[model samples]
Target: MKIKKILNNSAVVVKDRDGEKIVMGEGIGFQKRKNDPVNQAKIDKVFVMKDPSEHQKFEEILQLLPEEHIQVAEEIITYAEKEFGVMINEHIHVAFSDHLSFAIERLTNGISIKNALLDQIKILYVKEFEIGLWAKELIKEKLGVEIPEDEVGNIAMHMHTARMNAGNMQETIDITTTIQEITSIIENSLKINIVEDTMSYERLIIHLRFSVKSLLSNEKNHDYDEKMVNMIKENYKEAFACAQEVGHFFEEKYRIKYPEAELMYISMHIQRFYGRVIMS
Candidate 1:
């Protein structure tokens, strides 16, 4: 392959028979100029950037990051793909690289950003959080940086987003934040403390996750029993009211009306948590 552009001493854009691809390896582009032939023996990875904007941004970010940093981040992404046994979205290449670069810079400067939704992330995305922890260890081993667990949560968020094919980082954050808010709404409305690690808490979390997904997808749950739903509203007035507050929260935040089927399910879950105490 002939070099088209040199991104850095370790990376170069090469024109192969297929197309223009980013080739990365240690010293791959050292002393290399445009039109220079890439040594196949030194090549470690090749990436085809399909999206024009994303491709441009990836090249820009790689220029700012060290070769070792890019290597370790790529390792983490590869690990995630193997662990999940699926090819993650290509967008993770740019997103994870940029996130890790910024995170390492801040941590090196002793500025740690706290992830408020870390606990929620741990509960809601168990597998992704595990991969995040693995990434933390790998980063320490390769880059000599000790990232905090909060940063690990952020990493997990990126992995989860990639796995779900939700390329927007802000949307993942929004969903997590909404889950936390919904949990608080239920606790405060029902005047009860939800015992963490309990089955009830887990069930509520799963339900809320599905509720958010349905709302986002504009999915209509048409299987609602009208009589049973009305009966739930009357018999479990407090629980239903709490669910209504959740609905209001969703409507205000997303401008999507929470469906009655979701309300019935949420109210039932709320009733389970009601009158429950921490089991010490």
Candidate 2:
């Protein structure tokens, strides 16, 4: 690979037979000119961005954010990929780097934003949250900045979206928010507190997560016959009602038509949750 453009002292754009790539390493770009042969041993990370805009955006990010911050974010991204045993969406490089940079900047200035759904993120996205905690430690070790646990939750959100290839950070936030809202609706409508860590709560969360994804992607669920739907509605009135409330909320919030099959499944889950809560 040869340098096409120098991004900074540690980073540069290179072109090979494969295509254009952003290469980073310690002092790799220092004192280097365009078309310079890249030192293979010095390369630490190489990002092959398929999209032109994404590639350009990352180049801009490297030019602006501190190299240390970018390096730390890259470390976290690498760790996440290895831990999950798969390649994550490439956008995480840009998104997480930008987010981590902003977070470090804010913390330096003594401004903090609490993650309101921190508890939910921990309970719902266990692996991602664990990775986020590891990322927090890595950031502190490398950058000498102690970010709050709320920031850990935010990091977990980024990891979750990247792993799922679920669009962007905002979409992850929307999905998590929808799950919480559905949980609240179930609790309020069924008049029972769904305890975390319990089988029912975990099942409900998983169900809601997939349900939200399906709704967002406009995927159809297996529809029940009218009689079966009526039987469920009649047999589990309160649970069915709670499911309806969730469907209504989804429709209003996401501007997407909520599927009846999803509502039925949600109702069944609610009924099971309520029964478990009542027994406990």
Candidate 3:
């Protein structure tokens, strides 16, 4: 592919079949100009974003970061994708690169930023947090900078933010807190520690996130199978009761009115969680 513009000796913008992308390597863009062929042997990585606005942001951020730091960050992301088996959005390459730069800056200045949701993240996003730990280790190994432990949580948040593609940072934290609250209520009712790594809990959190987002957006839940819901409510009275309490919590806080169908589904989900805890 021909280079469209050079960012530095190591990086350049290239127009390829996939539209525009940032290509980087040891000396990929050295002595390069618009329409110059990209050197395949020297190529380290390419970053592309589907959103033009985000792509612009990526380019702007990439220019601000040191080539070495960007290279290491790229390696961390590559590890995360392989470790998690999730195709993280290219937006992360930019968003996380910016975040890491700032985080490293804070550490160098003897300033530290604490992630408020550190504990919540550990409990709710076990896999991501574990990957965050790995990311932190890589940062240390590559950058030779020992950041504070709290930074690992921030790294995990990046992964979480990448996966959900939620709102801004605050909104993402708020979503996490809401999901945690819902899970806590169910856990307290059942008096069991949630095995968050399980598929059942995975389903529960997905449903809860959708429910909370709908509540905040003032969207209504559609009616489901009335017969099945009734059967669930009658047969799973304990779980239904717990779900009713959760519904009340949201209603009081967000003024969301949950339909009976919604409540039944929540109860069924809770029942599944309860069953798992018991069986385990």
Candidate 4:
């Protein structure tokens, strides 16, 4: 790989076998030149993107945010991508940088803003929230400032927005709030934690995500087997009862009634969750 362009003393645009990549490290670009062989051992991070537009936006982000903040954001971005097993939006290069920069500045000046949705974020996006907490550690390590824990939820929200490709922050908040409510009702009714980070928990999250979308869009699921619903209700009595409560909870809050079939499937999902937690 050869250095194609130098962004600063610590970062450079490099040409690799795959394509152009922006590599970053401590003093990696210092005294570097175009077409010079890049010392692979000195490289710390690589921003590789298949989308040319995203790449362009990334370059813009590098220029937009301070290199120090960008470095922290890069670590967080790498961790989030690996943890979530998804490609986060390139906008995060800008969104996350801006947020972190502001956060660091505010903390320096002893100004703190409490995240109103902190609790909801923890419950609804458990994985992201955990990553957010980890982010606080990195921020403190690199910046020498201890930001309040509430900042984790705000950080997680940005990462969640990047993953969801959400058009607006409010949408993530709205969906997160709805999912939190549904999950709360389930946990409260069933007296279980839902055991975050398990396959059953993943399934539960997926189901709740789609269920909220279905209800919000008024997408009526007309096809349902009455016998199947009855069978589930009889065999998985406890799970079915919890699912029924979930349905009723939604009805009371959203004025949306889940179909009997939807409740039955929810019961099946809950049953699978119980089986997993019990074995563990």
Candidate 5:
């Protein structure tokens, strides 16, 4: 291999044996003086070939990118390969590359992807969000900085996308909308003027979490074995019971029947949750 153009001490564009333009960086091959024969042993990563004609374009743009941006790009590529089995070459699209880089930046900055429903869903989904959270934490620990939490949902969505084929983008949007409805029901039904110190609201939130996660996971995976299906039903029953108990608590505490709108909301939530889990 020979350097076709050097962007900086840390990055270069090189030509492979097939005469394809390969993006090479400092950590990729053995360290050597300029013009020395490139050592294959030190190569840290390789990127997919953009059209050969774009080599000049790449070189020109690369020169203008900040060193930090380039460094973060390299780090994202490395982490994707090591953890997520994503090939660097496979992510040549500008959007994918940028997304991965931003995710890394957030992770390095100590930002956690906080889902308000995370605690609630632990029992039903076994904390699938934890996988994304843990990945972020690992990056922070390794890079010695906190990752921002703003894009946690994007990361989780991408991870979910990788796990299953949920059809087209439209289908995914519809499914997600349905899931939100169910969660909203549980949230509304739990609203009661109970003593501030009571744990009823807390327990209700936990149940809602499980219901939402089960719905999401089931939709994403598109598979539910007999045992898993049974588990979901049991969870829904428990969640419904919890909702009813909260309603009763409210009626007794407030000296009025829980409004019919609340029951309608609860029914919608349960139905939508179950529909998503079963049909999606």
Candidate 6:
């Protein structure tokens, strides 16, 4: 490998034997300066930039990002690569990278994009909270660390939020809100109720999942498709059935109505959260 360009002390652009390919890394060109030989051991990963112009444009965008933003973007990229197995080069598409940068920026600025999406985020958040609680219990049982509940919840919230949003705030919020509003109407009209301690989470999860599926299937034609309206209505029927199951679950377990407010709150969360899954 040979040095193509030095992006920064910790990063650089390089070319392989095939020639003119762009590779990114932290220490690829550490010892050697510009126009110097690069050791193969130091090379991290090589990528064929199909469009040199696109690569240049991407580089320009990165240059405009603040150092803190860059750091966050790196963290997101690293996480996606390590956990989700997304190649670094492919992960840096304009939409994906831009969304990641914006999300991190919002987090740093103390803006809860979660609230913006309303209900979707809320349901996912509850699931996140539950997962956190479960993780904490497992940690205590296995390692005896007794992790703080708040810390677990916070970490889980961030993880789930990041996953659902694909590191994009606005998109996540939009999808979430749409699901929330639609589900809320179904719950209200059907007169189903749920409780926090008794089957509410399960019910909310079912409704949210179905609602999101419905919305995504017709999201593009949301405004014009009469068929979409029909699909939404059918989805509502399924959601209502989930709600009824919750009511039944609660009635059988604790002999109570469990209040409709719990489902309503979950609806709020679903309505506000956004983002789509990136299929591999």
Q: Estimate each model's TM-score.
A: 0.93, 0.86, 0.68, 0.63, 0.45, 0.48
Candidate order (TM-score): 1, 2, 3, 4, 6, 5
lDDT of 1 by residue, 147-187 (tens): 99999999999998898565477888888899999999887
Could you give candidate 4's per-residue lDDT for residues 212-246 as a string of tens digits?
Answer: 87777789774888998889978899899988888
**How many backbone clashes can be found in candidate 5?**
17
Q: Name the candidate, 1 or 4, with the larger TM-score value.
A: 1
> Mind giving the per-residue lDDT tens digits that candidate 5 earns over 1-280?
7765566555566766676454555654335444455556655555545565445545554566544555554554455445645443332323333565555555556555654433323322222344446646765655555554434444444444433342333343344443344445454654322221234434434444443334444533233355544454465664455446545654554344443334333443454444444554
| lDDT by residue for model 6 (1-280), tens | 6677765444556666666755545555457687787666655545565777866765655455543344344444455455544343443543444644564455446654333333344455665555556655654554334544444544344445455325444444444554455445545644443333334444655555654444344433223345543454354444434445544554454354433443333333332221111111
Tell me which residue pairs clash in candidate 3. none
lDDT of 5: 0.46
> lDDT tens digits, residues 1-280, model 2?
8999999999999998998999999999999999999999999988888788899999999999999999999999999999999999888888899999999999999999988777678877899999999998999899999999999999989998898555777887888887888788888887888887777778888888887988788887766788878898899888888899998888898788787888888888888887676678
* Model 3 regions more than 4 Å off: 16-18, 164-171, 179-249, 258-280
TM-score top scorer: 1
Error of 3 at 144 (Å): 1.8
Q: Rate the local accuracy (lDDT) of all candidates.
A: 0.87, 0.88, 0.79, 0.81, 0.46, 0.48
lDDT of 3: 0.79
Give the higher-TM-score candidate: 2 or 4.
Answer: 2
Number of the candidate with higher TM-score, 1 or 3? 1
Model 3 C-alpha RMSD vs. true structure (Å) is: 5.6
What's the count of clashing pairs in each model shown? Answer: 0, 0, 0, 0, 17, 25
For model 2, what is the error of residue 190's alpha carbon versus the real structure, in angstroms, after optimal superposition? 4.2
- Candidate 4: RMSD over Cα atoms? 7.1
Q: Superposing every Cα of model 1 onto the true structure, what RMSD results?
A: 2.1
Model 1, position 133: C-alpha lDDT score: 95
